[model samples]
Target: MITANPAPEAGTEARTGSSPVRAVTRRKKRQWLPYLLLLPVVVAELLIHIIPMLIGVGMSFLELTQFYIRNWTAAPAAGVGNYRFVLQFDEASGKALLHSFWTTVQFTVIVLALSWLLAMAAAIWTQHAFRGRGLVRTVFLVPYALPVFASVITWSFMLQRDNGMVNHVLVDQLGVTDERPFWLIGDNSFWALIVVEVWRLWPFAFLALTAGMSSIPAEQYEAAAIDGAGVLRSVRWVTLPNLRSVNQVLLLVLFLWTFNEFTVPYTFFGKSAPEQADLISMHIYQNSFVTWNFGTGSAMSVLLLLFLLAVTAVYLLLTRKKDVDA
Candidate 1:
């Protein structure tokens, strides 16, 4: 001790001091281990989704066809020519595209409005405590639980003009009309498609709104009641405010899904959809697979994707601005 503690061995001190640095390095490695473990998943996603999406985008710029099915790389370059053909609306194909786009817009709007309203009402009604509420909720979800193909096909059968339940009830029993209505053909096809879609989709909205309603505190309703707010007033003020965020996201998702919907219409009307109910998805399919114009179809697909992205971005921006203002 009197000899300055043997001047503390330099190597010994260095070795002890480096323990913490080693531990920190190991901790950093541990932090990265999870991501490393996720590498396979990321690779799979890129292969399955991102890679095909990129290929589709590239194909949109090329004159790919059934002829190039075996060797896509050899397809000719299009240089936005397909895009111009789609947007110009001067030719028969372009006019059909424009018409399909408008029809999709109208169909989406109608379905979204009806589905949201019906779901909101059902959600609010079910929120109140009552006997057999659980049973009712389960029953409400039956339509959603059914397989889409089965449900749509069943509806198609029911909507048949001859000996169908719908026509039988309206024409035979109710006497609403003297003649059987051709629900699957003519302008009535549009309304028939809407009915089937709404029946299939409303349960999804109901489930979403129900989940949202559960998170709301009972205190808000009590406070509103104290202020003499009736059921309608309380819903308008308290419930709607609490559900605003949910509604915004739900509405957008429904709009996108309905706009891109194919299964219901396809299963209901088959490959040749009525011109009145011709959705963009069916239109693209007819052009690509039926007519063997993969190039133009790819271009339309790209345009649809871009349009959805733009619409989503604009909607989010506007909503964020409104939230900030609020």
Candidate 2:
């Protein structure tokens, strides 16, 4: 016959059961710790970005102008009047806004194309280890690392019509043209803006692309090589496919930054950008500050915010779907 087992002590059973409970408690504490640390950042973001954006959205519905500048809250409400006026298209203000929108679209497209192409080329070139590679990479980053204000100001001075380095080089040294061209004025200003923007932005793109490339496995490239894939072929089949995630992020960020660019245009053309180069940022600024029409400006800003949000959402959705499918 088998002997009966002894019953476990209550204290022993309680201690064994409590162990898991204690572990779970500790795990919860661990999970909450990071959030506790992030509390300050969350608060700061709410204060700095969210609050002001809400206030601006509110201001969009108001008849706030220079008359009520001293007391914005006391301004009369317009109740969507500002939005209606901006979207009327037939009106002068609407026409100006539409023109600026198209200008910004063109500017953003060219910048994205040029910046990505240059960045991609540079990254691919640097992918193969070679002499002076470090120096070349450093040179590429110089434009990105330079102070925006100082660099843009220098560009402004260099772009001067007379007695400028650009003109000097073209007319005196290279003799590309008989007369000095007005780089900071007329249609040339648009091209000048593009050159400066591409020069400034491509380095950052190169940095991002290089980082993406580093994460790609060398064996994959070797395998491609064994399959008779050359440089272009490897990039098409392996490099780009691997870097799809990086390109998605890079292109979206570049698009947003280029679209909202203010400093380059402001520094290049002062308060008034030429009509051809009148980007939406300067347009909004002129409407808000120069005309002292804060209500209209706020409306335009809200529209822009909505547009960017929509674009970002759509892009993320499409990219996520592609990722899932792959």
Candidate 3:
């Protein structure tokens, strides 16, 4: 005999039956809400970051007017021609382009070296407690903390050749009596510009590395000493190894930051920046804004971004391998 529907359990079957639909509806709602929330962020990024990047890349391959929009009637498919002109220093493109590229390379390397070295040294030296540690740390950071343009202006004032404080101290007060050296006048004033970058950046590196050094165990050093290691030896063996990751990250970050820093060098030297200290960002600025060659500026931006990406990739590869090996 067919059993009549078993006497319905109180609130059990109905609850169980509805639970699936409720769960599915909840799941669907949760899924849709996230995408909806994400929509604005994604769209914002696309409009601000992604769109500009795509436009830059597109502009790199096309000839264009001073305004940057490709002149449809006269525009040519330049392919890699623009890049070749910049990189290969095509005589047809003129000496200015080659000077820009070489100077950029020089500036990048010098800034990277000086900033990292001084910062690491300062970080290590300051690891030992002394009076004024906090004050000194604040002092070191002040350069980077200052507004870029303001700092540049201040530095320019300090380095001025004629009535400049630097010249007065060196020539009249210090009794050097040498002709005053122009800080921003000559094409070889790499020194002036380099001082600005290193001064601004070392504090950042110092902050990162000093904190890393502090976290390292004191016992490790004591152990190393017990094993007959000197201070330098212990550092090479223990400190450097521990610091590798931080060093790697800081180096990469400074590399990118220094490479892209525009305001300091530009404000200090403008278009007359020493061939040795001019950088990619300045090149782009001059091409896009000074000359209003937006198309070429956009192209330069694309190349600079690609260069930065390559650097980032190298950093990732090196750090990943180190982690794996460890």
Q: Relative to the true structure, how large is the alpha-carbon lDDT of every model?
A: 0.89, 0.91, 0.76
Candidate 2 whole-model C-alpha lDDT, 0 to 1 = 0.91
Q: What lDDT does candidate 1 reach at residue 54?
A: 91
lDDT of 2 at 227: 100
lDDT of candidate 2 over 1-326, digit per residue (tens): 01144455634432224587775566556867768999999999999999988999999999988999789978999999999999989988899999999999999999999999999999999998999999999999899999988898899899998878899999999999998899888899999999999999999999999999999999999999999999999999999999997898889989999999999899878878999899999999988988798898999999998999998889889888888999
Task: Please give the clash total of every predicted structure, in order.
Answer: 0, 0, 0
lDDT tens digits, residue span 211-266, model 3? 88999999999999999999789879988999987787788778878778787887
Ranking by TM-score: 1, 2, 3
Positional deviation of 66 in candidate 3, in angstroms? 3.1
- The pairs that clash in candidate 2 are none
TM-score on alpha carbons, each prediction:
0.90, 0.89, 0.81
Residue-level error in angstroms, candidate 2, position 272: 1.9
Between candidates 1 and 3, the one scoring higher on lDDT is 1
RMSD of every candidate to native, in Å, equals: 10.9, 10.0, 11.2
Candidate 2's clash total is 0
